[model samples]
Target: MNPVHDHRRLGRELDLFDTDPLMGAGLPYWLPDGAVVRHVLEEYVREVERAAGYRHVYSPVLGKRELYEISGHWDHYSDDMFPPMRLGGGEGEEVVLRPSLCPHHALIYRSRSHSYRELPLRIAELGGMYRSELSGVLGGLTRVRSIQLNDAHIFCTLEQVVEEARAALGLIRRAYDDLGIRASRYRLSLPGDGDGKYVPEPELWRRATALLEEVLDGVEYESVEGEAAFYGPKIDVQITDPAGRESTLSTVQIDFHQPERFDLHYIGPDGGKHRPVMVHRSIIGSVERLVAHLVEAHGGAFPVWLAPVQLVVLPVGDGQEERAHDVVRRAEARGVRAELSGPGHGTLGARVRAARLVPYQAVIGEREADAGCAAVRLRDGRRPGAVPVDELLERIGARDSDRGTELWAAA
Candidate 1:
């Protein structure tokens, strides 16, 4: 990647995140600006999930070793997982940092009995998980040991699996459009012949793979072998970075193995217990990788709604300092992220250049301050002339709410 477009470079320059040698590789800490961006994205995903009938829940990051044993992680995926830590000297219970959220979610579903009335129970969480990634392959946020996953699992009957998966794919597409992410293609990742990474169940694998195919009906996708999950097959949404590297950014999977291993079931109308299918979905994968892609995609200039410092108020001279401060206050009152760049910083032009990535800039001078207006400068270098404080705030709010790429509303 070019230094100008690399997320690692931009992250350092924009004060997004950084890694400390003491903290170990693949572990990066977010700065204030980065935290704001992450917080906004998290809230946005939660709102989308809630509106789509998904119930949010919280789960711990650590799980008992036996949990993964039952969920097949220990048997099939222990290498990529951290070694279990013994609580006591040597004979105490062992716990592990989970490599995936599914096992814990499975436990949550089994906490109580369910009926067919809640067949399509969609559960969502923005949770943390850990991976034992090799240091040689770790770079930036794209490959990290700790991950905050935008993950969900749906427990539904056999009949509801197709529709649920379809809805998940639609949600992913909608989110990408709003986030300014373009997917390269859809990949149907199937298990390769004699691949031991997959669970050892031919009939179960066949059923799961067929069901995913049914869900992908009419969707343009490429079938690739050896990319399926250990427990099931999945549809991977692939994307390319500015550096020409391709990776999966979103995914949908159908797993019958975990449901069977965990003995998950729902009561049918006939009063008989029936096994429920598990559909795994992620709208934007991990928060770290998503932000990395976003940083490179936008070159640190985020959309207005997602930008850390959305608006910066600049005073042309000392005489307009009070006016600039008032503008900042008004913008903040209206729920816009606003800051002030005083004349002491530098020339108005220099200050503007420094904050070039900011979405909006409000420059207050003597004439504009007298008229209770400010010269509006957009990040894209378009001047909207002098706009009244109320009108300026309204326009910014409108663009932000719409999540559109356009800085100003159409006339």
Candidate 2:
């Protein structure tokens, strides 16, 4: 991998995130710039989910140990889960950092009675979960202990499972397109033969696998064994990093085991109770992993809408500082993530270099500032040149709103 394209190195150079030896491995803290990027991306996800009929929900990161046991995580996935923490005394109540969000989501669905009208209840959350990855294999945000997953669960009748799963895949594709991500391939992740890691219900496994296959009817995918979740089969959207290492970035999983274990059901048209199928889908698996792939893929040059500092106002000299500040203020009022880089930072060239990865660089000088305009430079080395402040903002706003890759809109 090119050092410039490595997220670990780019993270340090870009002041995005950092890991502390004292804080332990696989745990990293986001710097201000990085936080901005994360906040924007998270908002983007929420917007997408909202438009897709997913109701947002909040759940605690820690759950009773019994919760996972009931969800089959404790039995089938405890090796990757944190050790249970007992409260009060050894025999007292035990809790653990959740390894996945589905268990809590299952509890939420069970919290209320539902009719067939709300059969396909989609619940979404940008929530945190933890993994107990060994230190030796941990590196940067790619393999983090704490993860903010773009997770959602759909509870629907068995008949609605295929359509819901198909819609979830469509959502993933839409999100990937907007984020400038290209999936390497689709994978039909199935349980391996005689794998104790999977749930013992052969019927549930077969049914879930068949449903996923139906969901992927026209899509190209490779069926791989031992990659399925313990509860069921899944469609894993894989992406390759700059280093050529492949990883799952997004997924749509059909879980029959959870609904059975949790005894979840809904009132059907026949006025009788029926089991609701659970579909687990993640548009962007983990925020950390997604950002890591983004950093490497874009080489720290994020799309304008996702850029930490969308635009930087650089004053060519001391005379233009006030004008530059005005430009930043106006940009901020318009919700653009703009900042001012003054002469005190060093020469104009140095300031530009510092913000090289920023989407838009607006350079102000005596001439342009006097004329109430700024010379515009794009991160991709396009010099649109001397666009009026209002016009510049309006153009950028259009691009941002569209989530387009173009730095400037067409005339």
Across residues 1-411, which tens digit of lDDT does each residue of candidate 1 receive? 778889998988999999999999999999999999999999999999999999999999999999999998998889999999999879999999999999999989999999999879999999999999999999999999999999999999999998999999999999999998889999999888734678888898898889888878998899999999999899999989987999999999999999999999999999999999999999999999999999999899899999999889999999999889988899989989999999899999899999999999988899999999889999998999998989989888887888989998776
Model 2 per-residue lDDT tens digits across residues 52-95:
99999999999999999899999899999999899999878999
What is the TM-score of each predicted model, taking all chains together? 0.98, 0.98
In candidate 2, stretches whose alpha carbon ends up further than 4 angstroms from where it belongs are: none
Tell me how far the alpha carbon of residue 345 in candidate 1 is from the true structure, in angstroms, after superposition. Answer: 1.5
Q: List the residue pairs that clash in candidate 1.
A: none
lDDT of 1: 0.93
